[model samples]
Target: MKKILPGLLLLSAALSCTNKNEKMEPYKWPDAKAPIADIKPFTRILHGDTVVDNYYWMIDYFKKGPDSTKVVDYLSAENKYLDTMMSGSKAFREDLFKELKGRIKEKDESVPVFNNGYYYYSKTEDGKQYYKYCRKKGDLNAKEEVLLDVDEMAKGHPYYSATGFSISPDNKLIAYGVDKVSRRQYTLYIKNLETGEIFKDQIDNTEGDAVWAADNKTLFYTSKNPVTLLSEKIKKHKLGTDAKQDVIVYEEKDKSNYIGAGKSKSGKYIFIYSSATLSDEIRMIDASKPDDAFKVFQPRMKDVKYDVVALDDKFLIVTNWNATNFRLMETPLNQTGRENWKEVIPNRKDVLLSGVDEFKDYIVLAERKNGLAQLRVRSLNGPEHYIDFGEPTYTARIGSNPDYNSKTVRYIYTSMTTPISTYDYDMVTKEKVLKKQQEIIGGYNKEDYVTERLFATAKDGTKIPISLVYKKGLKKDGTAPLLLYAYGSYGSSMDAGFSSNNLSLLNRGFVYAIAHIRGGQEMGRYWYDDGKLMKKMNTFTDFIDCGKFLIDQKFTGKGHLYAQGGSAGGLLMGAVINLAPDLWNGILAHVPFVDVVNTMLDESIPLTTNEFDEWGNPKDKEAYFYMKSYSPYENIDKKDYPNMLVTTGLHDSQVQYFEPAKWVAKLRATKTDKHLLLLKTDMDFGHGGASGRFDYLKDVSLNYAFLFSLEGITK
Candidate 1:
């Protein structure tokens, strides 16, 4: 600990030390010779096609043996090059980091959520690197009990994360999933709350989530496949038992489906959801009947998707059965099949039923219309009404409403201009009381910023939504710089919510835009459907088209536009650049999944087999040709590319670091122009870099610094 402390403190000092002056040069480009990765050509044959990859040896990064491995050496060289290149902006980056950190209240606590007999919340002290999980018995005025001091837990580890935090019904024992490797695999630990003693029982390599059964001694957890890292089995573990003795209560035979177990809001049942990209199946086990078998609530059907929420004597189901936009359905608990399900809320093409939450008498439906969230609340037998949120571009959904019998339901509201606000809506009284809104410690005025919702037409004539925000006085006359961002995969909506960190960009005369492109459910199921599989080109093309529209609409000039995305979004950045390399002045791709064809073809890779419905099976010749056609790595041409900053964690489990390492190597070898390409690999951490709250800001600062340097906005 003493050995690591000095170096860490020095690094902190370097990052926190800001420049006294704001005036600076437009940019100081990294002038050092780029590190060229050694080429060892490897041949890959798939679907009767042969390809040679020169950087294939980079895959040795995952191999165990020594840090001296050639792969490690190559990555280290790149890191050194990055450090050398960005050395000029170290102080500037630090200044950005300090300012970004200043916006956040260091000593902050989350809204207390009442559950069972306790009100639980997490708090971060001023100097702490992590939060402390705490709870109060019966009321808010009661004495506080610390459940888990994550700062203490994180003391000795470089990377630490608590995956699942669950407590026994009696509240005597707390079960949590801990991950020290940052690989998304966690080990379950049981701790006695009263005695502050951790038990001997340890369950490893799980999905990190555990659902407690009514039988206080029993816990059900999902296990991840060691090879693919996909949740494949649910095991029943009894307290104090050897992990080897855990029973495999359920096993998902389909490798494509991910299985998970969770207790219902009502706490009456533990539901196991097994799903793939286009299909879903749910099985429910009564909480009281921990020893009984789990009964299938609905059989899996191709293209069918649904989630179950247990109610008093029935189950509320949000499903897309014969409904592209999804609808609400209910069936008696005993009649658990789809045939017995009856419509509660019929499907509407204009609206997408995203999810549902249940209270004793009230049912809250999280709906989305025209790319905005709408929460509809109603009683099982009373009038139904939509919770009004007047913001044009905001994200709102039910928050932690754990107590099933409570009359008040909590929901969080946020827009690009509003800090996160939590509200307690009394379903009975039809009144919303603001619980809390995050405080941006350093003076922040929402009025100083302006937000706009714009649309761009895709090649197919599909209208794509783009949410933009910038400083109030910024002009749309094409002089301003813009950073366009999007993640058009997995049907995840990139909501236009508040980000205190992003204020750095908006305040700097930069227009920040989120392209609600296809592949995201922003415009409902069809939006996602049109962007994936054989139609996946829409994801890339839509992003490109959005950039063109922004340029044409004079939001930003052609050379002033920037682009950024991570993980799958990183894939977007990679593709858009390949499709329209001249559109962006700079591009940031973090932990990018750029080697599409190769990655999808490799079933042993995490999420590859499971995401076949998303990327499609390369074993199928049709899927192979289509993916290969647009794969960023495979499609790389000897053309000038954007000034690019690519980042990855050496320990990344999703989208292996080698993907970006290899992609950059190819770019350096093939690109016609020397448009600055920088790759920074964090030796520690995984897909989600720097687990520490404030510590993570360093990466953000570097990214912002990179963008600022390009635009010559050093201040």
Candidate 2:
């Protein structure tokens, strides 16, 4: 498993500045995170072990809690993974605990948490639920404690599954949602963490996110109860007593009772964003009481819809529509018992506000333009200036807790290209410093690999951007094996970044390319619109175009090309293989959303009806006709297709395992020839395979091996 040390060691100490309000400059990237970044095939650290490039991420030293140092060391050291090493859990946990006991003084028993980072995990065998908690044993990397026994909490509730929960700022009050399966409604409950006292009587079905009031005398949360046909009702829970006071803060009586309430750090006003299915709006409400005195802050342009991010108590930053792309605007909030408003930052067409966090004197915004996200800071006192933190080597995302403190300006920035690192920037000094960077067990070298951006036109004449990476000196001849990856659905953007395993593929002379297709927001909402509903066929055609483009550009031969995509993108891969399998040597479909017509037509399906907007509703005869035309599973025909590696998870809640399971079964049963089709399911994980990082790497490696097998690369 990959053991990335705590994020302290990965950051390069460098500072650069730029003008924020000045004319935009071309993309100038920063230095690589590592100086000697050769494609690290493996890394060995601390304990006696080794980690392979493919499966290294499975070891999560961060989960070890405060003193993750030892966990990191153990993870940095490679462990045995032979048949003998695959013993039962008890022995494995015992051995791990024993090895860690010397470094971690805390005597908590070892427990396995889900590696996806979602607040859900189950045992390997029984699939019983467990919760993650921590104890401060003076070790920053304190051992994590997993509480598995939920029989008490599950009593009297048919929907004993955990829904949503929040721990109070002081870590005292724990509020959680308990869904009742029959009513299809979720009830909220409160528990005192310190006393271990449960207040079940205070449970109510209508509550959503629980927000603590300024005085802490009452808790406010949004709810839609009493079988309301109107808007969601907001309610208050008075602490200490088994009482719930219901108050209708806002009501629309519309089909969309969707309302989200968020309290500003100052505690004077609460920002409420409400929308139906298509568009959304942001408004403000008085935190003190329920009244018509609530004021709505409408966008300057009604055509320009938006979402709000509270930059500070007085200013609410908004992301507004700029054609298909989104632009950011900030307006000051006047919660003075009177309706008042003013704009702080007007809309700028050239830049997209990618990040924002409020500080003592300034608000920081990381804006993206021309495929690059830059950090810029604006002060109420001084002119706004771009914090020339330098263009990150990869796509950078900035975020921070809403609690406005002196240190709140220091934001946690992470990228798919770089390890998660924390940085502190002084609003006063206009200076920046790296707080932490992730540690790599293996050494690195920069000159060993290269990345480039290329463009290709789709069958529909739309230009598709592809990010290409491979060893620096690979010849342009159409001989090298190529891996074409695309996830062109759900408005998701596949960003450019550094991948430890992908780099391994690059080092192995395989050209890795990401096809920025129609369904993603890379180009904007229109791009997504073009690939969804009846337009879904464009996604596959786009992939075909990309593969053909690769051949035309002489990047690789038709026999050396492989196509890969998962989830919605899996649908893309399956469709492309069906329509033009000759273009690819092999196909890797992971947790695919392939059975569209049947699945989307059924209202009983988990995500079917809700996703009708993204994928056309198959319930309608017209939509059914449209979806059937492109549904991969339904459209599968007896033809010569690429060798396929089909991967799925038994417990996938999003795209059910039955889809892939049934698709593979049908393909195997119906296909005419010996086209090799492998169906691998990691019975443990859900939509994400294998719980740990290393486990996921193993899955990916096996998948790559399967594709490479088609190219005669595997034994």
Candidate 3:
């Protein structure tokens, strides 16, 4: 008879695979733990010009408390080992170069917008900012130079900062924003990218999102006073020796409304959409004066109830909500004026319009009819000629603007089960060619990984979806360590996606799961509406239900389970830990919004009032009672809870570090056992613990080490 050990038994066997001779010695764990450094109240995190990409990571850290901030670059020396981002080793750079070169070449060339070849980073040293742009192309030595010196650019303005920049297509002028003492209000500046000379004219506290018009001299941006979504106005600014700033368009002032602006393809017209209260009705604005570049569009869209998708000189695609389902409706640009409206694509009951892109004679619609989301192109130049791009293996999500080169349309595709991969679909050839594939994060195989959707009944008998991922072959034993994750707030859904880092856990014999609870839009708007304000406790109970369901199915035991969530989900994690602390072995709360009541009470905080709709205002008695019910900071009680590791950032403007600090302090004072409450705050970084990639991974590795330690696997 042949005997085979189950996965749990095998994992336990593997964890003990260390040398017996070493195990014989007394366990030597690091005695000294890194102390929590004292942080200043007004510390700010720094961000790099480089986007958070695959091989590169940007991190901000404070060597000396809040007074100084430094940005560090983390480059993965090799794709083989997902390790450090910042190291003074030359061998690491060589490995990084080899991996980066391989990945860069795989990118689709049709979308020749910007390459992640150069490093653009700015840092403030000795109260002066030093900006540099370095590019390493081919065998060419690294072309690195100072792009701008902060002191030379803005002369008189005390404490001038440049951020949110966009470069002209010709790469001549750089449109950067300069903020005063208050980061909220900023003025736009036109700086010569090469000369580093800036001319500030359209400087106003109300100025917001800006984009360069094709003319480069003309700037189109959204501006508003007090920066409210309700009263935002779109304006145009001329940038030259002598320029003018004017309100090319103005939206109706309504507290409960939101106005969004978009430009047409030909630049002949600018489209403005008005949503009085709900994001439904979209009105178009045609410039009243076509000759003046800073002209406002006429305010009126035909009573056609729909959401704008794409607008061009020829056609406009909109997601129209009929009596039942959301459908795609297209109208000719010529007839889409104030009183004239004709539907090119009429409303269909079953189809849910996702997105659309327009070319000269054709319009491409990305729609989800059944469960399938595919791209469909319709040519209006001829009769109703249409072509389907076939059902993609995964859903195809189109960006705001997809690059079209000759006869090819390039876009990206990904699904709950597929890794994000880009492709270029040839319009004429009707062939789909793969452009780039994400690195095949090894250590685990897809065939061994299995995902299933389960609905668990909560305390209120409401069914919540739980996405579970684990190794395929596992016995129905109550010994497997389970990591139940959830983020149940702000209508943010924990969608299915691949993570190279998560692969570490799967290989180490852990079942990973996400509770798609209420207070999120995973299912729909109603899900979020149900779990916020007075009903916020539902998030906690739903998470508990997920854990209970796993135990009921004999997948995990009480001491072998862990609950984790971050941000709003962090609130969920903290609440659950306090409510039922004995249920889990450990918990990880990352940049959590735990101090709910106090934080929401102050309107001065960023995103506080804006979130009033989500979390009821604490001022009202009814709201106060309900909000305090599940707020982690307000509800800490005397109990022997599981070990918890809470993370926060001193520079975090969104979820202040004080919230977690207060919560941890109270938890320590109240809890009976020495419930190892570790508070790690990145003094220089914001909500994200670190700015660079390697720094993030290092923290992540430390977190996992702590978690694994609680499971009897310590260094």
Scored by lDDT, the top model is 1
Off by over 4 Å in 1: 1-25, 63-68
- State how far residue 487 of model 1 sits from its true place (Å): 0.4
Candidate achieving the largest TM-score? 1
Tell me the tens digit of each residue's lDDT in model 3 across 502-587: 54455556777778888865554456667877788887888898899999987788877998888888999888987888898889
Candidate 1, residues 535-599: lDDT per residue as tens digits?
99999999999999999999899878999999999999888888899989999999999999888
For 1-715, candidate 2 gives per-residue lDDT tens digits of: 2222321122110001111112222212222221111122334331232323321222122123343354323222211221111222324233222222211212122221222122222222121222234333234355433332354455454234554555554455666665434222457777775677777535556543576554545566666543331235555567765545455556544332266566665455666666533456666765665343456766334335456555445555454544345554544555421134344555555555544666545667766655455677777676777655342335555544344544425555544335445676676677767766643334334465566777798766778888777766777778777899999887677867656556445544678888888887666556667887778888889889988998888888877888888999899987887788678888888889987865665554454544666776655668777776777776777877787777765445567666775576556555775555666654444665543222344565466555544554321
Rank ordering of all candidates by TM-score, starting from the highest: 1, 3, 2
lDDT of 1 at 424: 96
Model 2 misses residue 201 by how many Å?
Answer: 7.7
TM-score of 3: 0.68
Which portions of model 2 miss their true places by more than 4 Å?
1-165, 169-171, 174-210, 215-261, 265-277, 281-304, 311-324, 327-350, 353-356, 387-393, 405-420, 619-622, 682-684, 690-694
User: Candidate 3, residue 361: CA error in Å?
Assistant: 5.1
lDDT of each: 0.88, 0.56, 0.56
Model 3 segments more than 4 A misplaced = 1-172, 176-209, 222-236, 240-306, 313-325, 330-396, 404-411, 414-418, 426-430, 440-445, 459-463, 533-535
Lowest summed lDDT window (length 10), candidate 3: 73-82
